[model samples]
Target: MDLSNIDLSKFDGLAFIWLDIETITGTGVYDTLSSPDTWFVHKNPDVCEDFICSDLKNKQIFLITSGSLGHKIIKSIHHLPQLHSVYIYCQDIARHTPLASEFKKIRSVCNKTQSLISQLAIDVAHICVNIGDQHSRLNKHKQALVWYERAFEKIKQHNGLTKNEFVNALKSKINISTLECQRFQQHRQQLGEGMNEVKYQHELLRQLLDVPTPLSSTEKDDKHIAATIKKIDEWERKNIQQIKTVAERVRQQLQKQINEINKVNKVKHDFRLINDELRQRQSEDDYVEADLQQWLERLQQLKHQLETTTISDTSQIDVQITDDIDWSSMVKLVESDVSKTWVRTREISMVESL
Candidate 1:
């Protein structure tokens, strides 16, 4: 198809896109669509209702796929209030015309083309415009500006776009951003008014509570009035005290959590430091743990191997483990800086060779 013949200049204020539903297999739409304006919405009954029928704004979507979809899926599009139009593009147009009519908002029914270079080129520019239109319709002017900027960038990158196109796109961006700022200010004003109303209501309640009630002057009513006043005062004081106690308890609990978090963080910090120090040590290969029984057993094994070997006494390395030792002196030696903490162990193959 010829791109020069395809006039996407008409996309100025319109929101529309093309979708190839044949590419959409299984339950959900193919998420790989390069354009944000177009989507490959698939049919899944068990999926969230919002994903199927919600989030779409005013736009025309062309489903470029052959064959009929499920009756339920076709009917589901009709429920979307934001859709301006839907177009079905099938290989055999006449065959699906009757089925296409069953769906609402379907404006045009057309045939699919073999080639799509021109269509792709048109989409590169118009997709952003369509997104902007949809955002504007939804009263999301801030989001619209984002799409407008993206459109501007697309135009900027394209070698064929003229200066007029650049200006128009920039103008669209400014207009949308301005409108969003205005809407934001109006929302802020509305919130302020709402807050003021609440304050007024609170003040009115305070005044009503503070106002003294009219009481009977008779002696019999005096005692009853005094008792009622005392009860109310007592209840008010207890309620106030309870609130303070609860607030203090909540603060204390929060502090405990904060302290625990700090302790954990400190431990993590120290562990990382120790690991870094260990990694920096060049003699890490020679590292060993001090164990008396293990060392003695290894020495005994070496002595047994020596006894079995047929070698000259001076040529062999001799290792010994005696049964008798001064326990207190050995303990003192270990406790002092004189005891060896690490010992090197030769490979088992070396011992066997001996």
Candidate 2:
């Protein structure tokens, strides 16, 4: 129920006002109220600072609204001396808002409904944001912010951060991640040689943001990976060059072998020609040798025949002529001439025998 509808007489010695502070520009939850004694008020705030500077003491207020609470409302509420504890309840956004240091001392409830259940939801988120913000200031490695997310997740609808207030939430998340990123960096150094720095950085970054290993974290991460890639590229280039070199050498060797084979074949062809010429010459020499043998045999036979005929015929004629000498015939005929001829013949035959 709204404060205006409630009975004021029953709440003795206390004042009450209805402040429609929510969604109003330059208006505050505390700036609208002006009460002298212990009071309870609800009213929409003025558009200027006239309401915030007004004097009032011993007040009790219930600031109720929906939608985003502006800086004017939140800031002015911190200045109220009479308002020891304030509960600014929202029926629009949930789980995302930039809270102040006073939030640690006071209470707040932001919800999407006008029921007790919504109130309880607001209370839960308030407590979590308060506690998480405390630990975040101490740089608690995002462990403390676990409570903040868990609180919202319990009653979350239409996305965990709640779509209406997600812009602020996104901002908050970035802030949280940035802090954790810094924390992980410091952690990697302390981790020393025992911890694999690459693994450590990667794991921490995983928690902070769902992204690839970034180059901004440390020089080692980028340099080491970059250097390895460089080496691999170099190796590939060298491998191609090496293969080309080996192929060239093999080609040269094959060409040399082909030249040697051609030279040997030419030599073999020349030898075949020489063999053919020798064979032809040998045949000519054989024919010449046979002709010489025939001539030598004919000469020997002719010489033997001539000697036999001259010796045998001359001897027979000598035998036929008697030694008897007739004086008349010897005077008439020339027997002395025949004896001279016979003596010449005998001298020739003796020379032939010697």
Estimate, for each residue in 1-354, the C-alpha lDDT of model 1 and write its tens digit.
111221223333323333443554332222222334445445442242244344334333333333454333446655554344455555666776776567644544556331222233234445555666666677777766776766655554432354675447666665867778688889989999999999999997776445333642244346745765665566557767976997788778656655655555555565565556556652455345544355546556555654544443233433344656443432221111322124221211100100
TM-score of each: 0.28, 0.22
lDDT of 2 by residue, 206-238 (tens): 755432333443564466557656655665577
Predicted structure 2: lDDT: 0.45
The candidate 1 region of ten consecutive residues with least summed lDDT is 345-354
The candidate that achieves the highest lDDT relative to the unseen native structure: 1
Report how far residue 338 has shifted in candidate 1, in Å.
Answer: 72
Model 1 off-target regions past 4 Å? 1-65, 70-72, 82-85, 98-104, 113-142, 150-354
* Clashing pairs in model 1, backbone N/Cα/C closer than 3 A: none
Give the root-mean-square deviation of each candidate in angstroms: 39.5, 42.9
